[model samples]
Target chain A: MNPAARSADGSRRVLLMLLLPGLVALGVTFVLPLLWLFRASFASSAIGAFSGGDWTLSSYETVLTDPFYWLVAWNTLVLGFNVAVFTVILSYPIALFLARTESRWRGVLTALAVAPLLTSSVVRTYGWMVILGDQGVINSTLQALSLTDGVVRLTNNSFGATVALIEIFMPYAILAMLSGFGRLNTQLEEAAAMLGANRLKVFTRIILPLSLPGVLTAALLVFVLAISAFVTPRLMGGGRVFVLGTEVYNEATVTLNWPLAAALSVLLLVLFSSVIVIYQRALRALEA
Target chain B: MTIRTSISRRAAVASALAIGLSLLSPAAMAQDTSVTGTVNVIGFSGVFAENYEKFIIEPFEAKYPGIDVTYRPSKNSAETLALLTLQRGNPEIDVALIDVSVAIKANQEGLFAQLDPAKVPNIADAPDWARLDGDRAVAFSQDNLAILYNTDNVKEPPTSWNDLTDPKYKGKIAAKLGDTRGVILLPILTKLKGGDYKESIDPGMEMLKEIAPNVSTWEPAPDCYAVVQSGEVDLSICWNGRAQYLHDTQGGKIAVALPKEGSIGQTNTIGLVEGSKNKEAAELFVNYALSAEAQATFAEKSFYGPVNTKVELPDEVASRIYGSKEAQAAQMSLDWNFVADQYSPWIQRINREVIARY
Candidate 1:
């Protein structure tokens, strides 16, 4: 072989050597466990024991046929959409400011945006519980204002879970939205303004369309995260909101039905994969 | 039939050893140094884990210096059972502490060994109700369900379960909707209404629905204790031991009331893991844990109701535990094994019928 070709082959071998560890790690941790979960999902579980019996489609059948589980799935989907929309909506202005800011404190401001992610989710969930309880800050304030006769129910419902999730997911939305703001130019908005476009029109004609991909990606990220969220919903829902995530937990740990948990998890995985595919297709079409 | 004989035989052997050991001095009851190995223990986390380690475990290690012990804390009994089951093939945990229902389920699956009474003579000290699974597992502690009221918020502290449904408590109560406490509440309320739980828990379901309006939150985050102590809710239905602990720790912000209508005990059990490498050491640890000294110390400090009938506690502490004679008489005995079967379904009912309506 020629020297150049030989050099290229050696570089290719080195690249594979570098990639080998990650591939092996993924295979051992993710792929093998996934296969094991799939096999367990097919196992006919005893009511309150380790899930193992003859392989059957019973678990999946139960998940698909059970109207109760379907309702939980629907609730989870609705929650996911709400959390995604709210998180993205709340993050858009901040993300735009961060992307456009020429201030020296931009780094610190950006760090503040990501700071909530540093605290453990459990701690954050507990904080919400305290703040949203019956005689909590909001309720006491409302009562003091004579807004109503009694304390309003804030926590322990879908509303509480949605509110907490939007906050918990805001950082992720901002980061995803930032990726699409790369091509955003102030000159385009300026030119549109000079053409007698109002602020709203300028945003609609230039800034919004330019940043649409970021918004979509951010929404998708937050949606998937919200769908799989266990702690915030579990703590905030207060046993009233039975979503797919909480039900999966109840089935797995409380009921000792591992097979059913695995089946439900498989459904979640399928949902996530579909989301990823849709995301990719939309992005490709937008680019095309 | 065969299972019965082996269990009776085991019981006979345990009693026979107990009689002889009663003659020996207390120090002699400690195991011989020949059984030398590590006993891996698993149990609940938070204060329970800390106290278990400090009270029962440290003394167990000191009493039998030969057997080294390693403590591993888990989130709950369900998590412990998952660990025990996963490691069933090559068992890492020799002895485990779990809720009675989980223990019953674990025993059914043969995850726990038929605890050799010969090895664990203190098994005789456990009362009849506490001696579960025909001596395969025994309740080390009891947690009674009780009404926890905020001292500031609740001027007239509730004395009966019926009081919770009163108009005064409307939108001021926190309840565990479909958790273990809720499941156990069914039997208690059923008994109160003169209906057998096995026949039907409709009486309990109806009562819960009545109390639903008062329930401000079905899930109290960070636990029922925190919510009540903060006066976030006027009252809660929670475990007595933890409430008592919080009552003292929080300087009387919370108070526990064992309603006159009576309540049920949630038992925490310990047993030998099936595939333990150091069975003798593990049994020694289990025996030490069941001893009166260990039980009394643990009960005194942790406020967990000791299952050992021989253990003596203060009047106030005694009232907190279901172990005391008066409280024991007041408790409605639940067949946890049967309840284990109904557990998942009961949770489903509470969610679909009771909580859903509210």
Candidate 2:
């Protein structure tokens, strides 16, 4: 072989050698466990032994046929979608500000936006609990202002859970949108404005279309994170709001029903995968 | 040559120190030689673990200089069982302290070693009911469920379990879901309403639904103690040990009530993990844990009722525990195996029918 060709082959071999360890690590840690979980999902309720137990579709049947499981599944999807929508809406202005601002306070604002991510979700959820509790700051202020005769229940419900989830996940949406906004060329919007187009028109026609990918990316990230979130929902919802994540935790740890938990998990995975696939296809069509 | 001379001199000094220690405590020296390894323990975390360390683990370590005790704390018995099951093939933990019902389930799963009475003579001290699966697990401590009320908010203490359903407590009662204390509420309610666990829990479910509006939170994640202590909820259903601990430590703000109907008993059991590397040391630790001295100390400090029949707690401590004959009679007995089997469906019903309706 020629020297260049031989060198090219050697480089390829070296690259494969470099990738081998990571590939093996992922296979052992991620793939192997995932396969084991899938197998466990099919086994009966016998604990300890992962295999050699009666193999059955009972776990999946329980998950599928149970109305309670369906309710939890619906709650999970709705929560994910609502949190995603709310996060995107709340984060857009912040992202735009971060992208457009040239002032020194831009860094301060960015840091403030991302500050919650630095602390644990559990701690932040606890903070929300204090603020939104029955006799919390909101209620006290409401009482002081004589807004109402009695305390309003602001927590231990869906509203409290959603608010906490949005607060925890908004930073991720903002960062994703900011990255997208950074890639935008300002000249198109400026030209649109010069042509007597209004701000709304410019944003709708030019800016939004250009940033579709970023918006979708942000929504996807927030949706996945929010749906699978255990701490925030468990703490803020006060257990009044049941979701799949909490159900999985209860089944696995509280009830010791690993097979059922695995089934529920696999269901969550399939649902999310379908949604992601559809989303990607739609995005492709939009781009085309 | 100089390095070798210095090493030999250091070794001679270590030998002299060992000789001195052996002379000081010959029994410790004998134990030190026999059980010379780390006994890794998996058990409860939080305040209970702190008390265990102070009352049981520390004393055991002091008594047996050769056996080092390493504690790995778990959040709950279920989590401990899951861990044990996961580590069944290559067991990492030598000893485990978990809830008795969960220990029974784990035993059925073949996760615990059959505890040899010859190795652990203190096994005889525990009552007959305390022993399970031919000594695979021995109950060491017991905690009872109790009604906890915030003293500041609650002027009239609740004397009955049905007080939780009172209209006055509307939007003020906190209950933890997916916990033993929460699940036991079913039987408590069933008995109060003149129903049995065998026939139907519908009466209890109906009562739970009726009182659902009064439940401020159905799932107090960390615990019901903080929620009650914060005065967010006037009353809660919680374990006596925690309620008593919180009452003593948190400025006497919380008080526990053993309703006239009685309370459910939650027994904590300790066992040696099957396939443990340090089986001898683990057995020694288990035996030490079941001793009267250890039991009395733990019961006095942690307010957990001792399962060892030989334990002689002080009067004040005895008053706080379910140790007296009358108190023991008042303690509700549960078929834990039945409860374990029924837990998932009951929890599901609570989540769907009761909490969802709320």
Candidate 3:
């Protein structure tokens, strides 16, 4: 073999050796647990000292046949979709500002945009609770200003939960969009503008099309996070809002039905995977 | 050869140290069994655990010098049971504190060790009702489900559960769902409507549907306490202990009323975990916890009613608790085993039929 080819082969072997540890770690931590969870999903009984017994499809049957669970599933989907769409729409301008600006306060502003991510989501949800509660700041201000006759119920409803979820998950969308915006060729937009394209036209035709990948990525991230969110819905929605995540928690902890929890988790995983697959297909078609 | 000699010398020194430590361990253990090892306790987290530590665990540790007590707080009884089940045959927890219903279930599952009367003599101090499954578990504290109303908003204190159905309370009541308070509400409603748990809960369901429209929120306690305290809701159904504690601590903004009809009694239990390595230490702690002094201290500090029959509470504390002995005697006694079997179905029905319609 040529010396160059041999050297290349040596480097490939070294690369494989480096990758082995990570692969092993993922197998043990992620893959193995996932397999166990899948097995637990089929257990017959959800009671007693042991978690598993005979393999059965009863858990799946119960989840699929129950209209209550279906309602909860629908609510979960709607919440996830709404949060994802809103986060992307609200994040685009911030992402653009962060990516395009060379201003002195750029770093500080970016840090401010990302500050919510640093705090615990539970703490942030509680903060929203205090602000949006019946006698909270918003209602009190409204009452004080004579803008409303009585206290408005905000915290213990879907509206409050969605608002809190969007706030908690927005930083991820912004960061994803920023990364996408950073990759765009600014000269393309300049060229379009130089050719008499209006600002709106440039944004719609050039900027949006170029940022599709980032927008899609951000939406997917936010959707997954929001759909699987337990704290925000539980705290902000205050038992009024039922979702798949809360159901899973209720089953596992309150009801002590491990099989049902595992089955529901599998359903959530499948739903997310389906969404991701369809999203990728749409992205591919757009590129083509 | 020199490197080999050095390795041998190091091995010999390590063996000598291991032997010395093993010899010292028994002597250390012999001096005082209480202080020599650690007792891993699993119990409620948040305010309850803090109070438990302050009134019970700390005082016990102070009395039994050299014993290290480690408290691992659990979110709830079900979670604790799940953990105990997971750790069965190789128990990580020496002692566990959980809801009485959960204790019954755990006892049925054989997760607890039968308490020896000689070891836990204070077990005799507890009421007969408090003792469960032939002393496998014993109730340590009790709380009652009561009507809670905001002092600023409620002009007249509610005297009956039917007050919740009054049109005057429309859009001013906060209902709690998927909690012990919510579950007990059904039994109370059933009894008020001339039915019982063993017979039919249809009347209770109908009543729940009627009251559902009045409810503005379904936030559970602690949150429900905040809602009532903030004067956001005129009234709520909550536990007397927590309501009383919050009322006293937060400047008397909330007050609990034991409805004239009756209130449900919720009991909290303590048990030794099966297969515990620290069984002796755990038994000592359990015995101490069930004693009149410990029960009285916990009751005074947290406003929980003590299960120890020997505990003589002060008038102030007793009045705030389940009220007079006659009133306490009137408090509804639930068959927890039956409730455990029926809980999930009832919750599902309430969620779908009642909460969903509301």
- The digit string of per-residue lDDT tens for model 3 on B35-118 reads 366789999887888899999998788667767799999878888988888998999899999998778878877989999999
lDDT (tens digit, per residue) of candidate 1 on A187-268: 9889989999999999888999899989998999899999999988888987778888888888887777788998999988
Q: Answer with 1 or 2, whichever has the higher DockQ.
A: 2
lDDT of 3 by residue, A1-288 (tens): 999999999999999999999999999999989988898899875552155667888899999998888999999999999999998999988888787788999999999999989999889888898899877899999999999997787877889999999989999999988876755778998999999999999999998888888898899999999999998898888677899998998888776778899999999999989988998899889879
Minimum summed lDDT over a 10-residue window in model 2 chain B is located at: B319-328
- Candidate 1 lDDT, B19-88, residue by residue in tens: 7766755674665676789999999888888889888888777777787899999988888988887788
lDDT of each: 0.85, 0.85, 0.84
Q: Candidate 2: misplaced stretches above 4 Å?
A: A46-55, A104-108, B1-38, B60-68, B89-92, B117-121, B276-281, B312-315, B322-329
Q: Write candidate 2's Cα lDDT for B121-209 as tens digits.
A: 99988887888888999889888887888899999998777888898998899888556765788887887789997677888888888
The candidate that achieves the highest DockQ relative to the unseen native structure: 2
TM-score of 1: 0.89
**Comparing to the true complex, what docking class would candidate 1 get?**
medium
